[model samples]
Target: MKVKEMIKENNRLREQMTPFNRSYLEDMILVLRASRVDPLRTEELLLEAAQQMLIAQKKGNTATQVFGDDPEAYFKEVIETTPSRPARSKLNYYLMIPWTALTLLFGVMAIVGLISEWTTGSAGMFGQISLFTLLSVGLGSIIFIEMIMKWMSSLSDTDAPRVGKFNIKGFGVYIAIAVVVIYAGLYLSQLFPPFALSPWVSLILSIAGLLGLKFIFLK
Candidate 1:
């Protein structure tokens, strides 16, 4: 089945679970997504789990009975046993993430620049973008992913997952480091020989990039 269809089916079935079972399933969803398993594999695994839970529910077995009380332990086994994506697929996913980030970042700046130039006759958000700016976005994506996984790590023990589960102190420290990374990127860009992109050119590159992501890397 298509990933979307599997997900739709899973959702429709999971709703039949008891309140306790449903909450446990929701926690599983959070941990599964945060685990960074392959997207299609993740959905398939989820649908299977949902199907099992439904069958067990009819037999009067709670989620904890069939799937173990500790989600931490159950999913640890599942994720470990799950095969890793092929090296090439892994490379493509990583490359796609950064490329998507880069194009979207510059695309927004391009639009803002065009608007500013139209009204005030001066360059907008950025006068020039540098190679270091690309480095920053790439690093930022990695950092963002690490932060997310770190937070999700705590959800394994919780009965239900929610935003309140995030650690405030950890988030504060992460935000500080992120602030430093942003300034550091801006400063490093000043050290490089930067080139200007006319608003039209920037916009065209952004559009072309989205097309490339949509077609060539169509995975």
Candidate 2:
């Protein structure tokens, strides 16, 4: 073939492959991101894959065909097998010490305040409720932070599955648990006259009841 014809053919092939290449790389990135893979390692793997795909395309094979039917699964498998840098280094563990200290200090203060309020009977029903709510929020935040840390740490270990990603089943379970807890709290509050069920509490119960029904029946 003439040199001019060969050059034209190469340009045509590149133009045709550009969109498919972009799509494949994008899908691979999503898989890596979902798996919590290291950013630097993710980029290196993507570049290497792109180069290999381009070479295959130059040999007249479609990149999509080479990648096969399930590109995401294929890329995920690649990421799982390839060795990468540790997700959390010793420096990261050292940095968390201050955070741990702060959390412990806050927890102790919260417990002390709750005990003082309970003994004195100074805080009104609403005030006591607010304090309990604050405690729950603090605990929930700690749990969420721990989950994120675990997920980050697991990224380097191929044997450890991805963590912290939300699933519908998990979300449903959370909602159901929250509903049950709130309902139980309201039921128990009735046993104590000081925390009598107010109109607002009744309204909350009604809403929760509706949600519980929906969760059960809709699913």
Candidate 3:
């Protein structure tokens, strides 16, 4: 194919990929080029990778998850292990940032709201029901988002036979923490009522807390 045609085709293929997959493929290209793999062979490998990704998509998996943890690392390993010696070379947690930030924001808001209600003696059956619902949904969303991210990260381990088991221990820990937090809130309610903050003030505090946590850990 002509150079212009190849470039156009490559662009077309990239446009079809998910953002994560496109980033992976770009990184793989750089690694392969540095290793001095023959251009034709490199293209072949990349095409195969794209095809595999499409197959995975059909099977209800994202390219990132199918490719596993580090696509570039996996590709490098494949190149080194294969008999072909046309060249030599060496090679986020970031994707979860938005989800983590949002999760933390909702979580803090729910917790603070719950505590406020309890201390103010406003946590009657209906109030408690609403507060629990908010907490449950927020927690559930965070868990679901983390699971998807972790699953994609796990794909980095090429040798792992399966995606691994459901996190029973993690679930238990979460339950234990919830129980402790609720107990503390109840105890504090009896000792001292929480001062009421305006809705806007509560929102500001929640956002500030979220940003503080993000900076402390994610930064």
Candidate 4:
């Protein structure tokens, strides 16, 4: 969502809630947004907020209930009317295009470097550049993948699949796992060989993932 709109909505919600509750709700929204959760799932999000507050209350940590009655109806209405957060799809595409073009150019150069290395039995500056180029591609891909995932997570699917469980059963677990795996890969790659090759590998994988995402969701 636009920052201005988000601020307006936040202010409106705050006005309706008690001071203590408003603070809790604001914190919850910030946390959810940081965790890549959609703000559009206002009801579910608010319930989660309420639960947190109640837990705090039980522990004598904080006593705050922003709503005297159930907030379910209000949250639902907000979700229904609120527009989805905007994605920087075009900006992502523009960024990707230049990277892809550079990758193509580097691929050609790398091939020439390899051929030269075979004939000369020595990798000169061009060979180093080739390796650097590959590394750039791989690391770039990993970063890009993370960025896309983050952007995707920010989006809410109003028609998301669900079962006899809370909130798209197991979704939180999936996100947690994803976060861990991404972090692990990033950490381990720094400690491994072919650190130079990392970027190329990551770039390819990221591009493929992007294509799959587009085909599945944007098609």
Measured by TM-score, the strongest candidate is: 1
User: Which consecutive 10 residues in model 4 have the weakest lDDT in total?
Assistant: 156-165
Question: For candidate 3, what is the TM-score?
Answer: 0.34
Candidate 2 overall Cα lDDT vs. reference? 0.50
lDDT of each: 0.77, 0.50, 0.56, 0.50
lDDT of 1 by residue, 37-113 (tens): 77788888888888899999999998889889876567787688777666877677678777788888779878988
Q: Please give the TM-score that candidate 1 achieves against the real structure.
A: 0.70
lDDT of the structure predicted as candidate 4: 0.50
The sequence of per-residue lDDT tens digits that candidate 3 reaches over residues 1-46 is 6444554666678777766667666656566654555556667677
- Which one wins by lDDT: 2 or 4? 2
Off by over 4 Å in 3: 1-7, 81-219
lDDT of candidate 2 at residue 182, scale 0 to 100: 61
Better structure of 2 and 4 per TM-score: 2
Across 1-219, the per-residue lDDT of candidate 2 in tens digits comes to 443454344345445555556455455555764554555555555555666678887787755677775556667666677665465643443334434433443444445544555788532343323333433443444445545544443342122334434455555655566566566555655664343333344345445544544464322
Clashing pairs in 1: none
Which candidate, 1 or 2, would have the higher TM-score against the true structure? 1
Give the poorly placed runs of model 2, Cα more than 4 Å off: 1-21, 51-63, 82-168, 174-219
Worst 10 residues of 1 by lDDT: 155-164
